[model samples]
Target: MAVIENVHERVLSAPAPAVGRLIDRLGSDGDPLWPSPTWVPMRFDRPLGAGAVGGHGPVRYRVTAYEPGRRVEFTFDPKIGLRGTHTFELLERGPESCLLRHRLVATPVGAMRLLWPALIRSCHDTVLEHLLDNAERVVTGTVSRPVRYPLRARLAVAVESVRLRAVPVPEQAALLHAALPRPDLADAFSVRVPPGVSADPQAWADGIFRNPPPVVAALLRLRNALVTPLGIERGDSSAFDTVARTDREVLLGVDAAHLDFRADVLVEPDEDGTTVTLSTHATVRSRAGRAYLAVVRLFHPPVVKAMLRRAARVAVAPPGPGARPEVAVAHG
Candidate 1:
């Protein structure tokens, strides 16, 4: 039964009307504010107005108030034990400048009472500051100082990415569907592409092949050693040929004496967020392939999942200083 009130405000060197326009676009396809890709994007069921129902990630709420260019407020759903309202307010300071503010006034209940100060507040503070940074960048075309994600925030993001699950090879995975029309073995795992991160299949593929986990690298070495004695081909990036590719998907595989295998890396975007799916399809061509598959199948799922999770973590990571000028622009 503790009430928490937090506020973050920024004075942008822009007119209230211009800043208000950005606020109006929150949760839309081309949102100019609200940091994303590094964090989940804010979304609403219909649009940004009173009665619009949505919130980013696990926090759920409905729009309790709205003012196109001046303000908007979201009241938390009681089921989650957060009873309060978070809002965005715009105040005109001058014809050429305005103050943008985000305030959170809520009471945490049950476990949230403990978790709020320990965890949620820090993450919330970082996100709100980044949101203000984005507003400055979108309107002023630059941010005087961009907020960098702290270690704890990075760890929180990593923990959340672990929850991503295996799903059916989606129809949008055209390359996978075409390459493995009928295959003896098939599986797919997906992770949401953070907003602002590159959705290029090549980028995601590089994540998988560039620097795999030590365990995965060790497994690959063992696989190569065991297969070499059987006169089977050793797998590596060089061994895989690019069978097909498009903006959304890349198909890479090798046709070995014992088996034919293909890996499809796909990027699909929907209302929720962009998803990167990694799918494997293989067909045994010889008796040796069957025996090899039996052993490999046991470890394949986890290996793929780990690789995807690693790539996602890398993609969403905040860029180190001097890494690239565009990094902040994208996140902002």
Candidate 2:
């Protein structure tokens, strides 16, 4: 049997007990570990202890040993292609310093050897680094060094960028009404404006889609190039229809590009400024929807950032003739 071993460790600027407490809660519900933006966070069926069943993403495993605040070990299910034990341990180096470590010892049988080194290893390295940084933030007030994406993860992101540009525009919305929660995967953006500025939610939506920011215009050009060749027609601002409205909330429905999206524009007035939250809920119902979304997730943050930046511009820019009256003065 060929055995594969891997280990990652970091020295935290906090005491062992502090590090232990964070480790104990790793995969349990309410786990505080910040997940890698590119992958699913770990989840456990129960608290860390012997016989607990849980894993991250598609991997499944069971706890083989446990020591609260000290160490815990997980043995992967053979079905996952790796027969091995992975353990998390904390060691006190000083009264106020501790070493946090993850050690995995496994035997790769069948096709796992290829999968482990190529896909699994890259994902594991990136996620583990993030996990350690999260622990450091918990122990210390801040992380001295933030997590940096490895080469492989960066390449994955580049591939995602190209795919986003190539996505086709759907002619109509998918009729599937099964709405999922705001989705842990959503990217959100917000802007604050002084209460005196009264921007009409409808007007804001109209401007947002009608005159897109430069970043968005570039994306649209890419989409147009791809769709034009396929003979698929493009949609305009008319595609964003106001479906629901209230004094404080406006929901604009969108049907475009293989996705059904609801843009929720919420305004909460305050003494200092009115806080605006622009949240977009999206769903894709194709047979490859899951895979499509995974790729989309990598690109979601940039989309939100561009939209919010543009909306802020719209709110603050002075009205020209019939220009949407400058209603909200944006604050960073």
Candidate 3:
């Protein structure tokens, strides 16, 4: 074999997900991304266009360096022999449009070059050209001059599945606010209200409007993560725009199926000490196919009730995995 081959970068105009799927397929056993490329057609019915529904075959590869809607890079299997890594980056061009960059690097340092020199480069070039052409058509809405049956059918299917809904800014803001995940799902906390703190719930609600802004921010982040996907802790949420942190609270659209929450806490002096009243608003939906809205109606009250109880402990006392005086359910 030889040392390392060259790195090639191809830029195509297409939706991010579409290009991404193609890259995933190319690097995997299959060819270009997605289950089908109805948006773009191959110049010829070659390897990139030919493959069964599943992965390519015995060839195996480890995918890594994935940054969704941004960059995804993966490495080919070395044990089976030849190895390479291809990365795809999706850059927004305009509304409902994006540019995709595909880079493939092949290394013959092992025994791949001598064993399959011509085979590797040919395969690599074929993939690059195919991806570029498909992307252009998908972006410009121009498929190969003469439309084919399968390609036409795929487009028809996609068209049938597409649906649109208009969301007002206020509604969008409310949705974003409610969908933020919850805290207890992240870590344990400890809360210690003064021993004589009144069990009165009214006092607790009043205290919140007077407490501080940071308290609410911290609470929102913690709860949002736990109620979100697993491992989606508050820390994870802060790393990026999973949920935007705006200068002034604004409603930015979040993918459906995502969850966000808002809470109001108030407290009043009770004979015992004080009482806390906590209220939460929740929003959730699913993300799939043409970004259509998924109507999700379920028993959300109980799930929220459990989370409020957990948050109460964190706010009143130091955070830990411990219980305090009984939290009488004045009204759960």
Better of 2 and 3 by lDDT: 2
Q: List clashing residue pairs in candidate 2.
A: 170-257
Tell me the TM-score of each prediction against the true structure: 0.83, 0.54, 0.31
Model 1 spans with C-alpha error above 4 angstroms:
159-163, 168-184, 193-203, 246-248, 319-332
Compared with the true structure, all predictions reach lDDT values of 0.81, 0.63, 0.38
* Candidate 3 wrongly placed segments (more than 4 Å): 5-10, 13-55, 91-99, 143-332
- CA shift of 276, model 1, Å: 3.3
Pairing residues by index, what is the TM-score of model 3?
A: 0.31
Candidate 2 residue-wise lDDT, 204-274, digit = tens: 55555556678777876775565565444454555567877766666776654555666666666654345
Superposed model 2: Cα runs more than 4 Å off: 34-38, 154-216, 219-250, 253-332
lDDT for 131 (candidate 3): 47
True-vs-predicted CA distance for residue 168, candidate 2, Å: 17
Compared with the true structure, model 2 gives a TM-score of 0.54
Sort by TM-score, best first. Answer: 1, 2, 3
